[model samples]
Target: MKQDEMIKLGISIGDLNGIGSEIVLKTFDDSRMLDFCTPIIFANTKILNFLKKQYKLSLHFQGIDHPSNAIDGKVNVVNVWKENVNINFGEEDTKIGEYAFRSLEAATAALKKDEIDVLVTAPINKATIQSDKFKFPGHTDYLARELGGESLMFMITDNLKVGLLTDHVALKDIASVITPDLIEKKIRTIQETLKKDFRIRKPKIAVLGINPHSGDNGLIGKEDEEVLKPTIKKLRDKGDLVFGPYAADSFFGTKNYKNFDAVIASYHDQGLVPFKTLSFGRGVNFTAGLSKVRTSPDHGTAFEIAGKNEANLNSFKEAVFKGIEIYKAREEYKELTENPLKKQGKKI
Candidate 1:
C-alpha cells in the first residue's frame, strides 16, 4: 500500500531503560509489517539507532521531523529529542521516564491532529514516568483526558476480553467506587466497544463480583447483594445482555467466561491476573470507548531484561496488529452507522 492508502501507525517509545525499545525494533524488523501499515515511531532517532546497534538488529529506519513525513514502505522515526542521553539498561532513572513521556506526548498530539490513524504504545515504568505534568496513574487516564472520551481498559485476545470497572484503585476503595452509575457506564462502554470495535452485534457481558463467591450471597459480604445485584438487574431489565456479579473464585476456573462476549472485573487484579495467565504474550491492552484507537502490549516494562534481547515481541506485535484492526473496524462502523441504508442493503 502507498502512503495515503495505508494506515499510519503512531508508536510511542516507552521507558528507554526497559524492553520498550527492544520490542519496538524487533517488531518492525519483519518486512511484512510494513505492508500492513506505515509505522511512525515517536522518539529520538539517535536514541533508537543507538539501541538498534546495541541489540544488533538489522532494522533500517529513516528519521523524520513529523508524522506527515512518514513513508509507507519503511520504518520512520520522529526525533522527539536531539540530545544524547546515556542509556543504562535495567536502571530506573527519572530522566529515562522524561523521554518516555516526551514520546507519548508527541504521539498523542499527532493522534489528536489526525496525523496518525492508530497508536501502539510500548511499556513505560509507571513509577518513574510521574511528573507535575503527568499526574495520572497511567496511559488510559492521560489518554482519556486528552482524547475526550470515557475510556475502559480492555485487555483482549482473539477469544477472551476483560474490562476493568475499578483500575488502579486501592483494595479498600474498590467497593465505594462501584456504584450503579459507574457500573452502567462501564458496561455501556464495553457493549459499544464490542459492537463497534470487535463487530459483536449482540454482546453478552459477564460481571465478576467484588467479593469472594460474590460475597457468598451476602454471607461473605453485602456489597455483591446490595450494589451489584440490583444494578445488574436494572441493566437486564433495559434489555442488555448483561449478567453476573458471578463468584470471582470459580468464574474462570469453571470456564464460564467462555460463554460470554466479555468479562467485567471489579478491580485490577481480579481481571488482569486471570487474563495475563491465559493470554500473557498474545494479548493486547486496548483503550476502548475513545474516538481514537490506542493499544499496547499486555505486559509492562521488564526492567530485568531491558537490553538483554530476551524480550518477547509477540505482545507488541499483537498490539500493532490489534490497533490496525480496531481502526479499520471503527471506520467501517462509522460508514454503516452514518448511512443505515447501506447497512440494510448489505443485510439484504
Candidate 2:
C-alpha cells in the first residue's frame, strides 16, 4: 500500500514510567494492524527498543526524522528527543514527565499541520505532567487550546455513550459551572459530534440532573430547576431531540440510557463513574468537537502494573480503531456536505 492511501496514526508516548509504551507495543505487535493504519510513535527509538527488550516483544520500529518520511505497513518512530531517559517503571520522575510532554507536543504539531490523519494518545499521569509549559489538568484542555474547539469529553463504547458537561472540575465548583450557557454549549457539542463523527442523523440525547431527583423540585437544590431545566427546555423548543434533567440516582440504574443516542452528565464523576463501571476495559475517550480527530484509552496510567507485562491492551487498541472510524466519518460528512445535490439524490 502507498503511504498516502493509509491512515497515518500519530501516537504520543504518555508517561514513560507508566503502561503507555507497554500497551502501544502490544496493540501493534499484531502485524495485521499495519494493514489498517501506519502508526508513527512520537518518541525516541532507542527508548522504545529498550522497552521492546524488557517486554520481550517481536515488533520492529522503523526510525524516521519526520512523519512524512513514514513508510506504510511499518511501525515508525519519530526521534522527538535524543539521548537516554532513565525508565523506572511504577515511579513518577519529573524528568520522565518532561519527556512525555515532548512527545505529545511533537505529535500535536504534526496533527495541526495535517502531517498525520488521526491521533491515539496513551494515558498520562495528570499530576506528573503539570509544568510551566504544560499547565492544563489533562490532554483535553491542552488540545482544546491548540486545536481550537469547544471540546467535549465523550466516553464511548459499543453499547453506551456518555458526555460530560463538566470534566476535570472540582466537586464543589461543578454546580456553579453548570450554568445555562455551559450546559447549552456542551449539549450542542455532543449533538454535533453524534451527527458528524458518529453518523447519527437525528440524535436523541438524555441529560442527567445536577442534584438528586432533579433537585427534588427545588428542595435539594435550585440548579436543576433554574439552570438545567430551562436550558434543556430551550434546546428542545428548537426542535432538538434532547430530554431530561432526569434524576441522576435512577437514570442508569433503570437502564433509561438505552433510549437515547448519548447521555450528558452534569459532572465528571456522575458520567464517568457509570461509564467506566459499565465499560471499563472497552471504553474510548474521544475528544469531540475538535477539527482533528483524537482518542485515548478511558483508563489512566496504571502505575501499579506499568512494566509487569500484565496491562490489558483492549482499551488502547479500541482507541486506535475509534480514532480511525471518526476520522473517516468526518471525511464522509465533509464530502456529502460539499455536494448537496449528490446527498439529496441519495435520499431519493
Candidate 1 lDDT over 1-348, as tens digits, reads 233699999999999999999999999988999999999999987888889898898889889998999998999999999999888999999999999999999999999999999999999999899999888889999999999888999999999999999899999999898999999999999999999999999999999999988998799879999999999999999999999889888999999999999999999999999999999999999999998999999998998988899999999999999999999888888888988989878652
lDDT of 2 by residue, 1-348 (tens): 132699999999999999999999999999999988999999999999999998999999999999999999999999999998899999988898899999999999999999999989998888888899999999999999999989999999978999999999999999998889998899999999999999999999999999989998999999989998899899999999999889978888999999999999989999999999999989999999899999999898899999999999999999999999999889888878887777877652
Model 1 lDDT-worst window of ten: 1-10
Give the backbone clash total of model 1: 0
* Per-model C-alpha RMSD: 1.7, 1.8
Off by over 4 Å in 1: 1-4, 346-348
Q: What is the lDDT of residue 89 in candidate 2?
A: 97
Separately for all candidates shown, the number of backbone clashes (residues 3 or more apart, or on different chains) is 0, 0
